[model samples]
Target: MTSNKEDYLKVIYEENGLERPVSNKVICEKLGIAPSSVTEMLSKLQKQGFIEYEAYKGSKLTSIGGVICIKLLRSHRLWEVFLIRYLGYSWREAHEDAHLLEHVAPERMIDRLEAFLNFPETCPHGSIIPKNGELFENTQLVKMTDLKVGDIALLVRVEEDGDLLDYLERSGIIIGEYIKIKEKEEYEGSVEVLQKEKSIRISYKAACQIYVEKRR
Candidate 1:
C-alpha cells in the first residue's frame, strides 16, 4: 500500500473507525486536507476493498485494511520507543520521526528493532504497541474527562498528537503520574488537576484525548 493509503487507514483506526463510521470532516481535519480530496480517496480505498464508505455517513476500514493499519501502528510505536529510549529524542520528536519511518521500514526491520529495544510494551507517550498484528485490550482505561472533581486517577495512555504531547510534557503530565482533579469549570468544561504537587489546568478537548485509570 502507498504511504497515503497507510496514513488514511491509520487515522481511521485512531478515530475508532472500525467500531463506528468516521465522518469525512473528521478525517479531513485530522489529515488537514480538503473535503473533496477526502471523498475521492475514500472512494478509491473502498474500491480497493480497504474501506467501506458511504456519503454523509462516513467510512470504516475493512478487516484487511485494519490488519494493515495495526501493523503500521506497531511499527510506528516501536520506532518511537527506540528513538526516545536510545537516541535521546523527545516525545514529540520521536513521534514525528516515527511517522516518517513507519511508511518505508520493512516488517522484518521493525521486528528486529522491536527485539533490539527489549520488547517495549508502550511508546514514549504511553500508547501500547500492537504485537503480532493484535491490539491489546485497554478496557480499564477511561478518558481523563470522565473523572469528576476530587477524583484521583493514574494517567496511562495519551492520544498521539505532537502538540498534545508537548503540552503534557510542559505540564509534567507524563505517564504513570497521579492526577487529582482539583476543580472543574462548568462553563468551559476545563479541569484543574494536581500532579506532582503542581496545579495544571487542561482544556476539555485535551482531557478527552488523555486516558487514565481511575483510582479506588
Candidate 2:
C-alpha cells in the first residue's frame, strides 16, 4: 500500500483509540482533506482490509491495520526523540520534520535510532511512544478547559500543530510544568492561567486541545 494510504489508517487508528468507530467527518477535520476525499479513501482502506467502514456510523481498524498503525507511531515518536536530543530541534520543529521522515525511514534504521535514544517512553510533547507489541492508550488525561479556576494541573500533551506548539513554547507551557487556572473569561470564552509566575490567556478552543492532569 502507498504511504498515503498508510497515513489514513494511522490517523483513523489513533483517533478512534481502538475502542470506538470514528466518523469520516472527524478524519476530514484532522487531515484537513475534503469530505469526499475522506469518503474515497475510507472505501479504499476498507477494500484493502485495513479498516471496516460504515456509511454514517464510522470506521474501525482491523487487526492488521492496528499493527501498521503502531509501527508508524513508533517510528514517528522515535524520530522525534532523535531530533530533540541530538539534533537541537525544538519540539515543534521535530514533530513537523518527523511527520515527513517517518514515512520514508526504514524499519531497521528506526530500530537502531530507538536504541540510540535509550528507549524513550514518550515523545517531546509527552505522547507515549509505543514499543514493539505494545498498544498506545492514553490514561488519566483531562482537557485543559475542564480545569476550574484555582485548580492546578500538569501540562501533558499539546496537540500537534505548529502555531499551537509555538504559542505554548512562548508561553512556557512545557510538558510536566505545573499551571494554575487563575481566571476564566466567560465573555470571551478564554482562560487565564499562571505558569512560572506569569499569566497566559488562551482561547477555550486551544485549551480544549491541550491535555492535562490535575495536580494535588
Candidate 3:
C-alpha cells in the first residue's frame, strides 16, 4: 500500500515519466520536505519493492508500484475535477484541497461524487480521468519553454498551484489551447506564444513549467 506522500509523488511521475528518473531533490521541492527525510523515505520505498533507488542515478517505480500509483493519481485528478466543477473550487485551490480529499475518499464516496459531479471525463486542469482506473503507458514530457518559433503544440499540462495557477486562468491560458511559439528570447528566456486570435508573452520559468505535447 502506498502512503499519501507516495501518491502525490506518483502524480509528478505520471505527468513526467519514470524512464527518465526523478530526483529526490525535485520531490522534496514539490512536497516541501527535507533532503534527509526524502532520502530516508526513498530508502524505505526501495526496500519495499516500490521503487528502484540508486543513490545519484535517481529513482523509478517498479511495475507493481507504478500500477497502484497511477490509480491513486486517477483518483486525485478525478476529485480535482469534482472540486472545481461542482464544489466551486478554483483550479489553483482545488489541487491542494483535492490532495486532502483523494486519500480519504472511499469507493462509496467516489460513486456518490461521480453521480454528484456528473462523471467528468477530465480534471479542471484538463488531464484525463481514467475509466475503471486504466493505466497509461508512459510518454515523453516536454516543457513549453523549449519550443522554437513557429512550433505548434498541444497544451498537455500546466505546472500550477496556489496563486500562480490562478494567474494562468486569468491570462486565458488553459489546456487544449493550440498554440504557436512565435519568438524565443535566448538570453532572458522569455517566449511569445500565439493562441486563438491573440498573442501573449510569458517568462522562461512559466513556460518551462508548462509541459506541452508537440503537435507537429
Candidate 4:
C-alpha cells in the first residue's frame, strides 16, 4: 500500500470510518484535491478491498484498511513526540516533519521510540496516539466554539494547521492550559478567551477546529 493511500485511510478512520461512511467531498477537502481526483482514488481503494465506496454516498474503510490506518497514526504521533521532546521542535514543526517521517519509520523503531518517550498518551498537539490494535474513542471531546461564555475548559486537542498552531503557541494557548471563554461576539463570530491572565480573541472558524476537555 502506498503512503498516499495510507493517508487517505487515516483521514477516513479519523472521521469515523468504522461506524459510518464519509463523503467524497470531505476527503477532497482534507486532502486539498479535486473531486474528480478523490473519486478516482476511492475507486482504486475499493477494488483493493481497502474501502467500500458508493457513487454519491461516500467511502468506509474495511477492517484491513482500519488496521493500516491505526499503524500509520501510531507512527505519526510517535514521531511527533520524538521531534518535540528530543529535537526541540515546536508543536507546528513537529507535525510538519512527522508527516514525512511516519511513512518511512520502521515498526520496531517506533516501538523503541514509544518506550523512550515514556509512552506518552498524545502528540504535542494533544491528539491521541493510538495503541497497536487499539481503537481510540473521543466521545467527550468538544469543539472550542461549543463552550459557553465564562466556562472554563482545558485545551485538549488542536487541529494540525501550522499557522494556527504557531499563533496559539505564541498566544499561550498551550495544551493542558485552562482557558475561560470570556466573550462570544455573535455579530463578529469570534470568541474572546482568557488564558494565563491574558486575553485573546479567536475566530469562529478556528474555534470550530480546536477541541477542549470538560472542566474537572
Which numbered prediction scores highest in lDDT against the true structure?
1
**Candidate that would win on TM-score:** 4
lDDT of 3 at 109: 78
After superposition, the stretches of candidate 4 with alpha carbons farther than 4 Å from their true spots are none
lDDT of each: 0.89, 0.85, 0.74, 0.87
The stretch of ten residues in a row with the least summed lDDT in candidate 2 is 131-140
Q: What is the TM-score of each candidate against the true structure?
A: 0.88, 0.88, 0.75, 0.90
- The residue ranges of model 3 lying beyond 4 angstroms of the native Cα positions read 1-27, 43-49, 52-60, 111-121, 137-141
Give each prediction's root-mean-square deviation over alpha carbons: 2.2, 2.2, 3.6, 1.9
TM-score of 4: 0.90
Report model 1's TM-score to 2 decimal places: 0.88
Q: Give lDDT tens digits, candidate 4, residues 1-216.
A: 778988899889879987899999899888998989888888999999999986677998899888888888888898999998889998889999999989988899999999999999998888888886685766798999899998999888889889888877786666878999999998867899998998998888788889998785
* Two-way lDDT contest, 1 vs 2, winner: 1
Candidate 3 yields a Cα-based lDDT of 0.74
Candidate 2: regions farther than 4 A off = 34-37
> For residues 64-109, could you state the per-residue lDDT of candidate 2 as single tens digits?
8888888888898889889988899987899999988888998999
